[model samples]
Target: MTTEKETLNYGPVLFHYDLFPEKIERHGKVKKVITKRGTFALKEAEMSEDERNWFTHVIQRLSEIGFHQVVPLYPTKFGDYTVQLGPKTYYLMPWFASDERNERAKDEVLLDHLGKVHALTLKEQDFSNEVVEHSYQYLMNRWENRQFEMERFTEEAEQKTYMSPFELTYLSHFHQIMRMTEEAKRRLRDWYDTCQREKRYRSVLCHGKVSRNHLIFNPSGEGHLLNFEKAVLDTPVRDLAVYFRRAAHQRDWSIEEGKALLDLYEKHVPLLNEERGLLISYLSYPEPVFNAVDLYCSKRTQYSQIELVHRLESRIRAMKKIRDFCDAIMIAPPPSMDENAPKNIHIHDEEDHI
Candidate 1:
């Protein structure tokens, strides 16, 4: 629990402490803060100068668009973002109204809200140098390093645990997944290179992380976006891909559902055929991302073995859903039409028609 003085120094809002086990984050601090102004999510993390600029730029831009997705309690001196406190920066945001629960939402409502967000233009948003280059470089570097880590981890796991059938099978799966991920990374790089070659590598300010959990609905059912930490200037299609991947995690989803969501997005920001293909191709990497996360979580000192296993299982499940989605798209054949064909229109008749 943060002391009164600590909370006072952190921001304008003083919060009511909740002693519950902090279910949302088992290993981290979770406090319910209250103040004369409003409540805010007080999180602590070590960030770099580049990351600081990224958040600053994103918050300033989102606020400018009147999106109301994320409200900075303490905005920057230029009224763009918040100030850093000590080595740990704190964000004073609106204490969401009581209505923002974790329950599932109907697909229609969710899709509509997402469409509205994607509709917002980034031209009016605040941005800075190094934002795009830093973010892109970070992702590319992670992809390269992560592949190496996965290969080494799989090898070690195989050498140590192959006595068990489950271990051997898992190692095999891990190796296969790593190779697929490497391919995805290569494709993504190619897409980036193509964009540069065509002089179409312009950055669009984006929410970076898009999901229902980051949304808050007001009394009138108006939805608000949140979680701007990952916001950075990169490919807009990458943002769309992240949303699609997350939406794919929901139940009652079909090809039509995905199409409807994408169609709605197209209304706001049209995507070229090639851009759409790039987004589709990028979907292949989530499984590898989860596998990397699984490896990292196992080494995290904060989590117990049970907690680690639970987190790994959830990520694996999400990855599996993404994999199944990829499979469905891959196995699809070109559309065929012969609804009014005559009875004699068999394989032999098809040759004659051609």
Candidate 2:
């Protein structure tokens, strides 16, 4: 199926690289370009001009700052890191094949690299009252709106004479879920109060989407991260929260395993008390379970009743795991930073970093 016509479809973008594809295999959004020279991953992404420029800048800046664990992007003959055609943007990198043997080590590598990225660019930003107030109020308003919607859903289900299995499952856990929501809101308030009192906050270069899938192992067995499309300068907790939330959904994931991983990460960059609270708040919100309910309500015909019920149950189980993890977090502080960390921490400005 790898014909000349198929390769030609991407020729306009490949022309800049001067590569003649012998074959191209589509893997998700990336095309595996098999040429006489070598195999490469040609990634197709949607990025505005600003996002494309910023993405290329983040990859390069990570290298310039001595954090080169990221996958190295290949440049074209014209020395451009990315190419554009119509509404799509394309970039190229060496095709690093996946290794199943290293699968178990993924979370460790992901968090470790994330910690390095955060520590290298960590900055204690001068507090801005206007900025802090706006951020806090925006998030609080959003959370309250979602809570009200869930309450309305519960009331509607209760009024029904005979509820569906999905409704029954939701009703059973409704009280526990609400408790978790309140806990998340309380923690968010604590974070906001601490920031206001201390007049301080920290920002770092965060891999906005932190997941095991974004990490790939090279032939040498070292893990190199890819997909920095959503990279940004923000609080370090943003990445940690994102990582832990996703991890909680896995069947083998445990509170002990989660805490051990957090300890490994804190060895590189220890989390402050407020940041820890923020991470807990982010994890406690049962948004995933709420999303399952929304999907059942909006698209029940698309999927079977049993499928929807199973999905809701799966999310509820994950929420329980997250609740326990939050409890363990409150018991102790993050482990100490590694002694080898530099005495002078690098403070990266948003404009300067990306």
Candidate 3:
């Protein structure tokens, strides 16, 4: 396998042959390596000095909790939670191999695994107050700041418009989603704040990005949640929404499937009804949030520009698909037969809407 490290030239920290001859796969933020000492993955995340210190504490807390499905690897050679290489810091973990992919597995199965992982680690983990505060503030800051920047991208100016007709159309739709995302962020902030006011959100270590890519399903009927770079002290259900988003990618899973996964997770950790709303909010925008950020930074005018634009367009197309899928689910709430409750929960696609 061709390792991306060899090709990516990010200044002086170039990983050389001396780093060892190993092949690894890039999954989300982590790069997995197969070696003589068994497979391991390196998680690279950018953080401020203070956040790095907090991250170290969070990692230590995770180690104390004896997290199952997710394992934290100590850097015995470096004597630190992570090695700072220029603009980035990297953590490591044991890479696990799994059997054939469970392509047909329902979304509930994914939720089941996520719930187990969340239940195992978040329960009783002594997350420091700093970490908890930082995670929330960071998330809110990111959501807010990104929303502001995305506004410019959505500006309907002739000069700012795309050159081609197809590009212009895609840009228009992309801007609309960006608008919806901003609104979603506002709602998320409101809900998150309410959780804080009610003391419903306990300070616990949460897998920030819980998706199919970060998971490895083993032949022994086990799914491992890898990549803890985003792991921090936050509401545990945040992980659930992220995982659900990935499951929602393929098809509109029946409300039964969603409930089944909820039950599976509840088995490991009990979730209050309010928590479910937060999870749904997190899932509202889905992948577009990430895609928007990536495209914002990826834009350029040169040799590699066309390729990046193509990728951005592709992601926008994906965003549309996800938006429609989520719309169908919202139009038909779970247990649609229940007459006492409202027939459908209106979900709008607008920037900063989450």
Per-candidate TM-scores read 0.63, 0.96, 0.58
Model 2 — TM-score against the truth? Answer: 0.96
Look at candidate 3 and tell me the lDDT of residue 341.
22
- Judged by whole-model lDDT over C-alpha atoms, candidate 1 comes out at 0.53
Higher TM-score: candidate 1 or 3? 1
Task: Give the C-alpha miss distance for residue 173 in model 2, angstroms.
Answer: 0.9
TM-score of 3: 0.58
Runs of candidate 3 exceeding 4 Å displacement? 1-66, 72-95, 101-110, 121-148, 158-163, 171-179, 182-186, 189-193, 196-199, 217-221, 246-263, 285-354
Best-fitting candidate, scored by lDDT: 2
Error of 1 at 161 (Å): 7.1
lDDT (10s digit) by residue, model 1, range 152-180: 76667667733333334445456556655
Model 3 per-residue lDDT at 137: 82
Model 3 lDDT, residue 149, Cα = 59
Best-to-worst TM-score order: 2, 1, 3
Give the alpha carbon lDDT tens digit for every residue of 1-354 in model 3: 754554343212213212443566677776665655666666678987787777676556544544455555555353666667778876666666655566456345556655544554443323355654676688778766766655554454335533544345446666566655754565566666665656545433567877666667654756665556667655676776666555544445444565556555665565544455455456655345456345545554432655665655665655555455445444443432223322222212222011
